[model samples]
Target chain A: MTAVRPFRPRSGFHADQRAGRLFAAYLVSLLLHGLLLFALAGGWPGHAARSDKPPVYYVDLVHKPVLDPQAGRPEPRTPDTPVPAPPEKAPVRAAVPAGPAAAGSTDRRVAAALEKLRDERALQEKFAAMRQAQAVPKETPVGLSDARGTEAGVGTLAYVQAAIQQNWALSPYLLADPRKAAGVEAWVRVTYSRNGRLERFSFEMESKDAQFNESIKRALVKSQQLPQPLPERLEEVRVVFNLKAMKDLAGLR
Target chain B: MELITNAGLVVKLVLLILAYFSVTSWAIIIYKTLVIQRATRDSARFLDFFWARRRFDVIAQGLDDFRHSPLAVLFRDVHQELLQNRRAADGGGEGLDADLGEQDRVARVLRRATTSETHRLEKYLAFLATTGSAAPFIGLFGTVWGIMDAFHGIGKSGSASLAVVAPGISEALVATAIGLVAAIPAVIAYNHFVNKVNVLIGEMDNFCQEMLNVVQRLPRSRQER
Candidate 1:
């Protein structure tokens, strides 16, 4: 072959070289941007792969004291149920008569006496009834617990108990948060027959966290028979307890 | 593995193919845009240089510098024809009556040059048209296959729950989305490139007529020489 000649740059060669470099840089930058986009959105598929759960809320029910009917009677009130002072009371009126002064006065006094006696008798009867009602057996019903008992059905309680026993078998990630442990509370309400066997058992209220509520619901569901049957005549029963003990027992904590 | 084994797999495969097509089409679009833009700029520059120069010899030298350009090629062909006619007239060897024949020869040469220039300008455009027209259908085919797979899965699973059906349908729909992704840009690029090519062709036609007019106006002896 002939000897190689030294090369010289042609006109526009530098412009062509610059254009090529710019094009290459553009391509490289586009590639890097696409990769960055992919990196950012790539986790979405995995996130979507996870299962969905429901939300839970706190609820409770408490019994109020019965009111005394006789306390409001229009009579000489006792210290426990005293009448208000004049500033707090409505205006009063004087009596009218239809006979001679002596006879009318006597008759008005008798009517007042009878009215007072009637009011006293009514108050005594109300107190006696309230006393009798209070005398009734006040026992917690079997399979009955706190506010959760009203919210959840008997089947839901059994389900919760079973789930708790199974260590919340649905997913390991369900109770991974420690905050959820404190939130998991069980409310059991029981309506017992005279023999104390569970007539109706329910999970009244659940934890605000969905996973915790589901676990509680599952636990109650699994424990069909209560530890002991309730006594007869206990019409209703309720119990509210945090789920931390149950979770610890189940080794889920 | 057969593509039709499951509709979902088929759909995913189709989407993947469509993605490939989209990527390739975008690359082509970018490349073609750059090429067409450069052609337009360079051709405009060459035309301006050709017209601005008063001397035919200077214009011819400039055309030589842009020998790679379609417009330059057209100009060179016209200039050659004009030079041949001038040479023949300067020689005065044969019929002064043959001036009409020389003009006809020049016209033929110009027509041939126009055809060549047009062909060069239209190069690779057919591929772009084909891509634009067919990409959408390809993507749709993928989507249809995917949906069929999703239904088949639902039938096999024996459950028509939203949880089960939604995921499968969503996955299958990805194919159709990819198809649209591939097709939209291709169609847009095709239209844009076609319009550009048409404009360039119009310019070429106008330039050819203008060159012809200038050639025809030359002094007979000067043109021949």
Candidate 2:
């Protein structure tokens, strides 16, 4: 409680400065926010429309190795003793590579060189059959590049594969990831009568990818029935889903 | 598709709230800056004008320019009190301006004026403090909620991949980022405005004492013409 206090004066500028400054700042912030929104909407990276990249799928046909059934017990070498053997006489490969060696591998690099030649003489005989078959109404088999090269067990395989290829539709979800899609390997064994009426079907090989696996199943189901009548000798057809052929059918890549 | 539309409802709501906080906080900052700046400038001018001339009539006549300054309000109140006290004292012809009680009364009047002016300067500062401290936490809550929803989506979708969860997480994080955006400036402005208010309050207090000192030396009563 001091007795008397001295008297002085001060400026009044701070009295209500907050209100005006706050109003202005609020306005400025809103304006700036609006401008930012406009900029974002206008695609500020030079105003180009932000078009989504269509996921490109480079479909590669992976040919599973055709295991030599003549494996484990090597046939007695016909006196062509193994050493750095002459390239002209390399053993057991270029034979009836399926017997017909149908598509004489138009692009050698794309053809996985798993073919072993027994002798050029045998290759000449199969090549003649392959050329004759190609001259007929040609049908490309789905799983393996050329089914005519096989012995006599692929007419129904060819028909079923063509049917599934025609029916398989790639889902857009699967289209987002082609790498994942390619790994989806599933096999369906269809039991059919000689008249080609499908009696039953079950997955023989199920790849873990559910969506891609489902697409393969859906394709077979969509086909419903094969195009041509099956031979009486063929009671069932086990078809390995060729995703590459499916991609070709779906026109995805 | 725009990422925001894909964001879960909780995240969207949180973003909306953060946006509101940002807009409001900016408003406060802008308003506070303008007010404090004007107050400082005009109040300083008023104080300088006051000290140079040391005249009630001259400065009081020009209180309009310093309307936002706490000091002006202080000066006006004190000046009015002093004039009233002086008029009362003149009729009594007591101990003049040197009278201890009269001096004490003027000091009391000044103390009161300073208290009220200081009060005025402190207005809206609590709002600033609240925004500065709470906004970030509010934003964090939104982020947490958004992440929770995102994880829930993954659980429902049965996909634990990054692509599945990334968009949701990004959307949720936006709330936290915006919260910080709103809070940072609010905190800066609040501290600054508080400091300015304190300086203005100090000036008003100094002014009260100076006003008393000047009045103490004045003649107790006007002589007969």
Candidate 3:
């Protein structure tokens, strides 16, 4: 009998053969992929492909807007003075005809309406109070606390006072004694032309201290001119200089 | 190509992975084609030879010509088991119980051979399956990442115009295109190869039964000798 060979599976040999085929196919596949990539790189869509790069738009940022938000529109104007609110009218009583059945509906409606009117009146009063609170009173400049005259005269006197105060100064050494200078007051009748020039000044009530009087006169002289033209009116005005008031204006205790 | 080159880092990585899948699957596709074609052709020829010869020893000598045939390899293995049984009987081990034992042993050999042949036919198919199922999602991940990056760029630039938004989106979509390119062929090839493998397995089943019938006739022939 012919000798039968030992049984051995050819799995290893078959595996090696399959591996070789796989590698060969890999090489072929790699070539095909390379060719495909080359075609894509060459711009595969013919002339339709966007070969030229997209346009690079440069932008600049600015704090102010470039485009006018209100272009082609009219410029809005604000009124120099606020418009006043319309005056409130008195509430008219709604008439009710006679009878209890009609009176009940009317009475209930009147009560509701009266309640609504009260709420509205209260709101209006509250709003008026708020407006009054918001409204600031006109204040005369400080150091003119006792100056009295017409509106134009007071305005002119205030201007004169301001000019004098700008130049007003007295050294402590000029006072003979601090306690003696305490009650000193000087009254001067100052004259000014309508063109805003201080014409002359004479003391109506002179202080006991001569240096104090001289200082007040010197302040008037150094003023040179009123800061602004006064309105044409009675030309002369009185200015009183009280030591306490002067001290207070100077912020001294 | 410009689109691929200009893609974001994550997108580039996704495209690279998809390219690898595409290339490797193509290689597998080619290799499986060659292997299954040869296997089917050789199995047909081997079966024809087996039926014409009707001689196990002669068939054994000719197994080399049909090495790619899973059926041929199965026959060779069972022929070896039959030879072992014959040698045992010639050495004075033959009895009624021993004959039954030989049949059991032969049956075991038949089962083992069928399993090995089935495994051989189904090899390298899982890679194709994985590529088909996973490649698209991986590409989608890349696309989402790229679009997120684009929106992040828009946030930094403070621009939502089409000029600013279009290029990044275009570059992002390249990943999905590559993914679809990779997955489509793989899925189609996977389905086709699965069908082919099933057909081959069916043939192996039929071949296994035929082999069992031939192996069962062996002991009677030996007893007559």
Candidate 4:
């Protein structure tokens, strides 16, 4: 090989610069990695995308429509023919004394007008009774706990009823009480926490029979913890317990 | 932090491995960036110096400043080969035949130098490729192990509620996120550096051919003459 010639001292300088740069870059990279780990360890509060709100559950308490479809249907109109004068016309006659032919005709017209007004009032009363019949059935004595919260559905209400009924102890002797059996009904209001703990309770409407009311109180006490936790929004329920209705619900004679 | 701190031991191990991969690969990316950029800049400037100066001795003396340039290395190697051939021809009193042989020897030297320069440019790039390909799977391994632990927890607790399972799953998923974090930059840097190296290789090859032509025309080394 030809003798190697020594060049100016630029190579060492270049190599030294490169080494310095590489070292600096390594340090920067280490600092960046440290920052990343620090940020991760800090948890970056509120940056999490997950929602914290509890899922809301909706329950349909009343499966059937509250208003009857037939109640809203227009009533059939009666023909406008003049109504015949019946014994009820005595009041109209008493108002009109003996008069000339023209005066008598006007009095007859007045009596007819009064008769039409009475018929219209009777029709309105009949419609009112029909509407009332179509309204929601009143509290059943079988203790279908009324869940007033919007979130409580038919299933939840049924669950509450079943849980309470499972712990209820209705004595056969109380049902056999001849004088008070039919009249033994009590309304109890119960409130619960999210964890199924019974928070508070009171007798909203108590029965006159002390024994029957005591039995209702005992059932509530026994069912202190519901089988399932109450829905978040459902906290209070009003339960009506009637001895006769309970007997009927249980298929007991 | 709780997500990582509360993670299972296996997942934490995986995260640690990924962190290693990420930090090292980033360092490699930085070092390579500086190296490739210097090589490219110096190579272009060396080409300018080579064309401007006609004397081989001047070019050889200037090679030190362009030491990072692959073209400069190729020129230096071929120039040394030409010098050796010139000495052999002058000492042996063989001119015509030795000149032809000298061209062949110089060509061989050019090829070897091109190969060496390419190797230098491509150094340290394999680690980036390895990090890109392996990190994600390693992270996935951690995630699978975490989920297994979570299910095991459920079996022991006898509870399958979201509250019981969610925290475990969240912690497990963190491994996957970290794996992706480690892999993405490595993959990007690997691709970028590969392209840069390829461009340098092409320049070196072209310079090798150009240097061979110049050596052929010289017929003999100027220093020997």
Candidate 5:
């Protein structure tokens, strides 16, 4: 009788041989697929290379303002007046005078001499009154309180006063009613660049009309420099344009 | 005619194609991730139920319930072979003493079953690997085509300014981005599924050997009865 052999399970079959084959197949397929993808997409490296360069951009320059070195001093001509050219032949015209013109001119000269004497008297009286006022020391006037000994402070104050006087003055031709503009008061805020060019201009308060705003904008644009060079640390120029004082002077209702 | 006849059109078409691939790849990635997750959970639950019963007859009877499971399919094949061998021995008047022949038959059945299940688990996984490995290259092709067209357009348009070059290049680049979107998830899923299937196959192989050991140890009366 043959003895039954003890059941010996083969470990070879138990080993993951199939798994290895599957893994190998998987890897091979992965490689082939990778190759196919590369062929289709042009590969990862090429895509990365393209991403490295950024697109270029172009922009246009606009709104540049020219600056003149000297500006902001009082202009000689008022809006109401026109500048007259010098007479080319004054001497010849003066010598050839008509008989009625000569007689009238003599009479006008006599009257002008009398008027000049009266003006001198009035000027003498005004000088005397100023001396008396100086002799009696009193409280400093409110208007003079802001007066500064520094050259820059004085210059800036003078510029502000002059600008206010020139633009805010009442004339029948300047406004619908000369008295109406007197009530308009505004603060001008000015910004300048390092090279003394006006960079920005604005009003702290609204102007009486769009025309006033436009005029201020034009004034700053036209003035290449402030009335005086700003102090080294200060680049912004600010001043109040007071129309209320003009209204008072004109006696507006 | 010159305005319309530029490389820009080609670049746009390539970009559109890449965009389609990229959007689809991302969708596949999300879908496959969910599928693999659910498969893993189901497989684990089935394995737990199979082992907890501790009786081969109960597991064999219930295998049909687990027919959708890859592991269950492997087990069913082995069980069928055991039943067939038992029936054959009964016909031969061996009275169930044909233990050696039965063992041989069972091993053969298991080996064949293992191969089939492995094949089933690995199905569709190849597509993932292909996408992962190839998507970037596909995108690059589109970009290259676009760049070539851009140069051609430049040759005809007589200008190399930014306006002429940027739009074309931008459109071309969309393809490469799409390729990457498709490839990354596929590569990840391929790796993940491979690992999971390998582990299940190992478990199945181990279980087959255990069943063989149990069958070999049965008493003669029990085997015949």
Candidate 6:
């Protein structure tokens, strides 16, 4: 039988043949890409971003926000004073109508309000007494303890300001083509844990735009925990997010 | 526009690669289209000429004309195998036995030749495949990087307005657009060329079968070394 060797085909010369053309294609590719980039960049030249009336006061700060909770009111506002409660065992209590007076609706309403005021006063006094009882015996006076923890720690004021300023981002909502509110204000009470992380913070601040308020809140959250360790026995802390500081940083004079 | 121009270095480099791929893919498209068209036509004409002849010797004289054709290469390989075996056996009783057994061995040689031709037809097709599959993800990575930079810019500027955000995002999108542009044609061309190559290879396989039949029909007395 004939010994048939396996047929082996020679390699095609086309790839080698097209070497110059392929290189040329590469050049053309680069040129085309450059043109695309140029077109994307230069297309619609003079495309101006029309802006709206600038915001009024860039930002405002209500040191405590009376509701946001208000501006540095050292004393909590008191409701109108309630009439003094009658003695607990006084015989006069039996003579008084229970609430629904048989004579008139106005009389009944007044009696009911007076009774309610008495109950609230007694409750407040009981709470005060309970608080006094719970207080540990210490060298510092009770009145001075609350007054001692100021709204902000004197030592960390600059550090806190810098950290908040660095973390806070101004969104388009605050600075858009046509701006919305002239300015926004917020009050934040940040209480820190021993580990320097936020323990609890009262952050619900009111603004014309909810989104604007949220952005500021987010900035506070994004601080990755504050830079300094909290002072032992210090708790009360408050910060005012004023747009004025941010605008200054942005050089928007 | 400024966003893209001022995009991070990595982003710019990604865009550059996408551009290169786009250019090379299109180049391949143009080149392959012309080459395949010529190859198909040559194959058809060569097939006609091959079948027109009754004798193998007469068919070989015109091989140069179809040298570029894949089918022509197949024929040359089988022909060479035939010549080798024929020369190995001198004209005697051994030549007779060799001729009887030659056809089957010749068929095997034809199969191998056809495979080689198919390999030639499919050259450079893998590049098209890789570009088609990977470019979109590459562009996506670039876009993701760009968005990260945009957010970083926002953090730096302390402005979250779209006025500040729009440019960076738009610049990032350019990468994705270019990547798609580069990949689309490559995918299409790859599918088309693969189909065409398959068709051409099928024709070669059929030609092998037909050649075997033709050789089988020829008289053993005429099968000389």
**Per-residue lDDT over A23-66 for candidate 2, one digit per residue giving the tens place of the 0 to 100 score:** 66778989987777778666576665454546687532222122
* Residue A1 lDDT (model 4): 40
Q: How does residue B124 of candidate 6 score in lDDT?
A: 73
lDDT of residue A148 for candidate 2: 28
Query: Which is better, 1 or 4, measured by TM-score?
Result: 4
Per-residue CA lDDT of model 1 for A26-128, tens digit only, reads 5754675466446555444654355334467633222111111122111232355433222322223454545685787777786887687677667766776
Per-residue lDDT tens digits for candidate 4, residues B14-76, read 999998888888888988998899899998999999999978888888888897787887777
What DockQ does each prediction reach against the true complex? Answer: 0.02, 0.22, 0.17, 0.12, 0.04, 0.15
**TM-score, per-candidate, Cα-based:** 0.48, 0.50, 0.53, 0.53, 0.45, 0.50
Q: Lowest summed-lDDT stretch of 10 residues in model 4 chain A? A: A64-73
TM-score of chain A of each: 0.27, 0.39, 0.41, 0.38, 0.33, 0.36
Residue B123 of model 4, lDDT score: 78
The digit string of per-residue lDDT tens for model 4 on A96-189 reads 4556767878877887888887887677667655554344344322222333332313444455666677677777766655665575778888
Cα lDDT tens digits for candidate 5, B1-225: 122224355555655555454444444444445444544565577688776975666777776455446556555665555555556555653433465676776677678777776775666667677778777888788778877877788889999999988877776676677678767767777788788778777877776786677667864335433
* Candidate 1 docking quality: incorrect, acceptable, medium or high: incorrect
DockQ order of candidates, top first: 2, 3, 6, 4, 5, 1
Encode model 5's per-residue lDDT on A24-89: one tens digit a residue: 545554555556666556466777688679999743111112221122111233343333332233
Q: Order the candidates by lDDT, highest first.
A: 3, 4, 6, 2, 1, 5
True contacts kept of each: 0.00, 0.51, 0.40, 0.26, 0.00, 0.26
What is the per-residue lDDT of model 6 for residues A162-240, given as tens digits with 9 covering 90 to 100? Answer: 5667788787445542455346677777765644576666764665667767777787788648655544422556677
Better candidate by TM-score, 5 or 6: 6
Q: Which residue segments of model 6 deviate by more than 4 Å? A: A1-253, B1-3, B91-100, B220-225
Candidate 6 lands at a TM-score of: 0.50
Residue-wise C-alpha lDDT for candidate 3, range A1-253, written one tens digit per residue: 4334345533311532556778999999999999898777774666345666578974421111111121111212225323336446557675758697788888888889878878877887787655643343333222223433222123445556666776777766444244755678988888877776778878899999877888898898887575556564325578887776667666654
What is residue A26's positional error in candidate 3, in angstroms?
Answer: 1.0
Cα lDDT for residue A195, model 5? Answer: 45
Model 5 alpha-carbon miss at residue B158, Å: 1.2
* Range of the 10 consecutive residues with the lowest summed lDDT in candidate 5 chain A: A60-69
